[model samples]
Target: MDAEQSIADEPEVTEKRGLFGRNKLATSEPKPAKTLGPLKMIWAELAKYPGKVALAFIALVITAAATLAIPAGFKLIIDNGFAAGGNPDDIGRWFRYLLMIVGVLAVGTALRFYFVSWLGERVVADIRLKVQDNLLRLAPGFYEENSPSEISSRMTADTSLIEQVVGTTVSVALRNILMGIGGTIFLFWLAPGLTVGLVIAIPLIILPIMYFSRRVRNISRSSQDRVADVGSMVSETLGAMKVVQAFNQESREKTRFEGAVEAIFDTAKKRILLRALMTSIIILFIFGSITLIMWRGALGVSTGEISGGTIFAFVVTGGLVAGAFGALTEVYGDLLRGAGAASRLNELLKAKPSIAPPERPQTLPLPPRGSLSFRNVTFRYPTRLETAALKDFNLEVEPGETVAIVGPSGGGKSTIFQLVERFYDPQAGTIRIDGVPLASADPAEIRKRIALVPQDGVLFSSNARDNLRYGNWDASDEDIWEAARAANAESFLRDLPDGLDTYLGESGTRLSGGQQQRIAIARALLRDSPILLLDEATSALDAESEQLVQQALDNLMQNRTTLVIAHRLATVRSADRIVVLEKGQIVEQGTHRELAAANGLYSRLAALQFTSSDAA
Candidate 1:
């Protein structure tokens, strides 16, 4: 046969087949995660874990309490032991006070670490679960808009970043604020005159904090995006490894991945350096202020205006004030960075799905016989609104009738299938099964009576039996085998080493195209619905395999209202009627012989394939 004829021909006999010939099924795109909100959403999530959050607050309070005690203990030791002519009993008393401070700090630090770590892990787990549940509720269109890696990044990297902010940053910021305030108050109380010079250092500290914090926030978000890009690249490449290797594109793929990694590293390095430099600057300011104050205190001690112990105590308290300021600066920067990331994540969590089921759905009465009527149905795909996918389409299929839909590519054949599945509602017009409007029906209930075998015959990463069981989850082994037999797949399946237990690798990659198609057919058979829809089900199979599957399909179609989107003329010829679609309109429709006699669109299609077959 010539090229087109050879492509269109199908035999009418059955045959045995081997596996290992199918292209992997197309993986669905990831859904766009909600955008993050500034800080409100982050706090909202924390509110979800109240008990743990309370524990976290308590730990923070204890940590701050212990931290404030350290400065007071040092002040007492210096003032009591070295100044005022040094008393033996007073020295022992100061040593005891210092030991108590160490003990309290050690315990508080341990508890704070434990609770924060626990909060981090728990929050991450909860966020992942929440995202997964939301994904399940979303319409299929969500996946079409995003990539798998993008979804995974939101579930993993984005949540982890938020976790770091929530579990550690918030606690540290609280502790530092308390310390910064308490340290300032004590410095004023202990050495009222020196506190003025310490207060002047505030403007110096605020400048660096504001500049570095803004930079940290921007760089943190950029770093997250770079990491997500790297993840997306890895996930897409590995998922389609077979295609990459088949085209011998390994070297090109490597270069692409390397570029992604380099971009991530470049961004990450900048973020790290900025954070380190900010910390260094804060540390320098803190110590620099303490050094200046100590010089003034030393002069007082030499003149005996301030005793030796008083000078020592004043210097030590001043150092604590500096340390607290440094911690506050670092913690504040962290808060800003986390707030930016939280803002993005909140955008995703807050989004409402475009397709939501009605709060009170109408109940549809089941028809005695499945009869579908498409009454002036019009639809436009979400992505392409300029051109109508289906415009005022009308069709009526009676129970036990087999109608074939024949058209060129993009002529709205798949759009009809999408409507039947309720994947998208018609923009205009009403479609009813058994006189009950689809829009008025409980969508889940309406779908239960229909079965579909799509062109791709996509399978999951599972065993043969589990894949078949997907159609009817509670099905027994006997039921599964019966469905396989109906699809002409049982014989081949029985020959596998483990029979029904054979593990089909990702997307049934181990099976041939024909074998996967049969498995899809088997799944449809298991559903055993009153209405069946087949979208080029056997188009990809070899002639030998197509004939066997066609026979199986004939048996399966018996007494069912069947809608077929046909690619091959032979299949269309056997239909009770053929509906010719052109540019989303059913321009012509009749029995194959009647349409051929009229020499319309059907006649032209037949002549193209027939003349080519004759020439071959």
Candidate 2:
């Protein structure tokens, strides 16, 4: 066997593996999330805590009532304290009434704060959990169009906005609305003529409010999108920092990040400027109308059309109404912003993954024997529908047999593994395992019968034991060590200070490429599925490590149906049958000796490898 019989005769396997590995598992599009009005969705979330919501509303009502009663208390203090027959006891009793109302106001305000704040925190937590769970269940195809960074931003920034609206802003708006209505009623009773003067300027205030409401909503939505863009840039750049530095692209990344930040600033500036202009207009109209109305009330008191106390009560009550009206504008802006956040979260929750179990899914065959067949399978990635990844491909594998698929890049090698795993249903074909068509079986049931080790060794930021246990969550410690030993990974795992408890950093950065691949193989071994799919499993390993892992693979493949996607000819020489694929079709297939004797594509590739090895 020539040394160059490996794919090292061509470009490195690692480089080719990267290109072929992408877009392999393209699932069907998920069900579109329902587009619900933001307020309606928020109400549904709040409805989950009916008792708390009731208590909060009751507290809010009491607080508003207390504020309204204060103006009445002032009237009593003025009228009774200085009555024509002015009894000393009566004056003292009126003061006592005022003090009692204040006490009620204090308790109600505190209760309102506690209940609303608690509700806000609780509701936001529930929303975040729902979004997270739904995201996990969504098809991987969703990530092709949407960035993880943007999704994360919605979970953090958008949820925070919802919390503020739910906790404090909602109660504040309701209270102000109550105050405005109560104050208006009292104003008309106290001095009807002056009340009429204040109502006339309502049109002036309403016009500006309408203008700001539309602009704030549109601008706020854009502002949020811009912020998410900034988050996406930061996440993408940081995750790829190694590549960025290796290519000396730090300055370019910084410039890209700065552009994202400036986009956010520009959007925010428009929103803030509109809010400021609206606030200025509201203040001018509210206090301007109050000044003119109160001047007439003072004149009425001098002429005897109204008493001195009545004039004071009218002016004070009118001031309360104007202040409440002003606050309503601010509250309206908050509600708008919160709506945008709620709308985003609702969309995420409503999305249903395409690969979810049918309403009445068929049960898979019991005691899997690992036989699989593909009849005229044709497929294209959901994201790349124009380009066919596999076209009318046909194959069959017997139980306990090992079949190696050898092909150039993008020859449907990885696509076969994806179809076997049922990540993406072929556009046209009948794929069966144990004589049962895949469409007739539940997706989860199909996956349980198969184990996969792709080109990359996917590892999470978790301990060694936890990562290994991911293959079979209920597996025992003894079983875990057994699988690791079988994969030739037991020695390195034993060397670590914490043994199985050693924390694997993000993506197993603590381990070398060969070590990570070994761990991946160990994970698959722990699954102990009836069928196994290995895609370039040893393509990245050094010579010494490859020899050891290859031996482990041989042991694991015993008595199991195995399909190998190999770039290196030397690795698959022992396979029971070899299939040469080109342009998504099987071009030639035979054992190593048969293909070499035929002097076909396989012979040419083998000759290149041997000649390259001889030159070295």
Candidate 3:
């Protein structure tokens, strides 16, 4: 590609970073106190519907309290009910209270689940919206540094992790913490000796759990990044499916996609093994220590050191505390994953677009008479900063004048349009529209006066009416029909099954190349902008279609500033002036006859095309 020398910058600045693998942290690593601050961003979202959060918290408290109270009823059943008398009335009364506590626990648990789940959904939605809104406004330079697919993965995959943390993990961890604390206190009251033994075993149980937990967090983050890479690959391939199929590379794409899937599986397997190991260790320590304590309590009961009912209470509550602690290990893992997700989303929200409106931008004069000028401008694309796309380029088009630019490939013809549009700012010099520097004016306002018909004839996957109306949002049906007729597109468009309402399909695939080109012309015609840019606009049309479109172009150029780029010498022969370029410098300019008489670049280009036997 000749353009590579002009388009390629120094290799883009590369950051060696993991995908879903960002914000690395080991589970056993001591979390900084400030690690909670990022969570505050999530809390701010949770604060939005305070009523729902409050209701959920209240329900969680009720559920935890009810669960803790169940062991008390067990104490009554074993102590008083199993006494020598063993009264049926007392046992029945205690059973009734126990059933009541179970019922309360069931109701509170249901409510808590509902409220937190809803918050999870709502907060994720809010964060996604904020990220998307910010993304839409960022400068094009931002995209040059970031792949769109990765940005998309952040919006979806990252937010989903945040959702799990918010809706499920946080609620579970808080509830279990309450249960563990309450149960521990009851255990000491019921059997002090067993409590002492249980407390002594806790640190031993926790140590391994924390160690494996850090390993799981790291593995989980890596797995997420691999899955996102799969997403990016899919996006990249599908967007270029035509090229892939054209080259008969279907098997290659399939193999590539499968490799990504395998990468995700490999990472996930590591995480699963670590998590399973952690669970096994914690469970073994918990029940193993509990069993030893139970044996000692049995001896105490037989010796009358502790009552049978009291020993039972100690056993049950100790199990409850142990279970909660085990669950806490898993909850902590999820919180770290959620924090990683939140941090990614925060990065997007904090990005500021390189191109932004000036704080007090000068408003362009209304009813703009499009007069465009580029003065001593030099530019290099951000990705290819080492190569200048255009250097010291100078040109000016007066209002209502028509100019045709002819050049070899890489002569910076297209770069001219980009600079005028301010898609990028040049490294030096200035661009002005109607005597006002674009830097002092809003890009949107500058663009409103110019209309472009790019080489590809881009269109949305929408009905004909919508695609055409995109040129001028407020166009009336009559105005649209008039524009269509002027572009020589009204006949074929009317002949379609649904006329204006026909669905164009993606990139107008349902239409012929000539038809799509005409539709594009109609759209540009409808814009009725004061300045027009035609980049190989009629290149796709047949000879007959070209004649009609050219006639249409003549009308469109009337009393308008027109800049035309074309390979066909016939198209620009009648322009008010033709400018020939070589290596980003103007080599010649004049009327066709004037340039042809010079026997220079324009004459040579004409010799290749205009004098060909099959030339139109």
Candidate 4:
């Protein structure tokens, strides 16, 4: 089985790595270390959009200033127009003040909405583009260990948290800061004595907000992490619906999913409760301060030290300060939550791909007709420890020479293809092409010279023409048709309603196994690379298709340096040289007739299936 199919055969949690392949996290090791916060890293990322952020911040300040000014207008109308013995013209002045306040608010509100929304959209788009670029740059080995679902969930769900920071929280924070500061100044201006009484309350309120803000941030991050777990579960289950039904495990799988969902709900409920408590505490503090100031203002009015109008103005200004500060506390909680998400996204952004191209590497020549060699090569899989996949293995293939590797399941047959493709570097020796080390060669440049048709012939959900053209993006219509003919797929393709334009529904499920394999071979032929690796290309085909497809493959392999890994004895019967592997060692090497006469592992394997007629 191929790596992806092998993963699909296991339990959903165990199988998650292949379909959405990712590295499994073990509790034995420490959990992923959390980055310290209030993270300045977020500011560093946000700094990339300084122009938009600055404009949004300015708009928020203006809006808050407008909101604070409204209460001042009320104070003026009460003290100057409603006071005993006030001039009748004062009413007209108050009317003009109210209209100016409303106009300022309207403009400020509109500017804040426009700028913040634009910034949010732009930042998220940039982040997604950067993520895709990074994933493209990663080598296959990196993906072999990491689940695709984990990466996808982080990219889609985790980055969404940053939207609030870019579009809403940023502006809200600025507005609240301005409102709090502006309201405090107005309060001092109207009644310095009352401002002194409320001064003590400000610290009491601020201290709790600061403490709870950090707690909320930690909890929100924990909540989002649980959400990612559920996403991983759902992605794995949906991808393996076939197996779930085959085994009649639908009820068991549903119950497992429900458990995951319930865990998420528990975490989310905690987050919601914390947010609610914080908002309520802030509200109570504001109202308590407001009550005390009102009582004091009433006493002053009755003593005749302050007029009823002055008492009214004092109450208006005090209420404004209290309300502004209270709202500031609420908005601050949202900022904390957004900050948590920003931290998660920023972690992914900072992750470096394990494989990277050399800074000053030589470019590979087009149509690389160069010698390939492995000298004492050795490699171990990430998860296994009993033995290496390839140990002290050595081979040399001259340009245009076709060599086939034949072995039992764990005899290191596939490892030869993997190393030749440079998916994993050998631990003990060197791999070179044309005297240039594979390690020093640019990964993209190296891959360009080789084509691999993996055992499963994996297909994408795309039209036949587009899928075939993926082999060579610059290929013409004739080139595609010719390649398809060479793979023995032209006949079936022509019978389809739209031929090359026909959509191959999700992974080519509409086609039979043999047809899909032929399409994959067509893709490889279109690539027209110097080195070709076929891992049992005809293993999944029936006798009829295999015979027809074998003729096409013979033509495709004629001038290329081919490395074939096969279990079927008949496929390798005509190979120029066959290397028989046993426990990562090459036990025998020769032509089919020579090896069979020797009566060794090769003879036994041949006796199993390689009759003269089958070979023909």
Scored by TM-score, the top model is 3
Give the range where candidate 3 is weakest over 10 consecutive residues by summed lDDT.
Answer: 1-10
How displaced is residue 226 in candidate 3, in Å?
12
Q: Which residues of candidate 1, in runs, are more than 4 Å off?
A: 1-38, 79-100, 142-152, 209-287, 304-346, 366-368, 491-503, 544-548, 607-611, 614-616
- Tens-digit per-residue lDDT, 17-112, candidate 4: 422333444221112224336336556656887887787787787777777777667667877777635677886788698889889889978988
Kindly report which residue stretches of model 3 are placed more than 4 angstroms away from their true locations once superposed: 1-37, 80-89, 209-283, 307-309, 488-509, 540-558, 603-616
- Between candidates 3 and 4, the one scoring higher on lDDT is 3
Give candidate 2 misplaced runs (Cα > 4 Å): 1-38, 82-96, 128-134, 202-287, 307-313, 358-360, 495-497, 541-552, 603-611, 614-616
User: How does model 2 score by TM-score?
Assistant: 0.78
Clashing pairs in 2: none
In Å, residue 389's CA in model 4 sits off its true spot by 1.8
Scored by lDDT, model 3 comes in at 0.80
All candidates: TM-score: 0.76, 0.78, 0.79, 0.78
TM accuracy, model 1: 0.76
lDDT of 3 at 349: 93
Write the number of the candidate with greater lDDT, choosing between 1 and 3.
3
lDDT of 2 by residue, 430-521 (tens): 89999888888888898899988878888999999988888899999999999999999999999998999999899899998888888888
Report the C-alpha displacement of residue 515, candidate 2, in angstroms.
3.3
When summed lDDT is taken over every stretch of 10 residues in candidate 4, the lowest stretch is 1-10
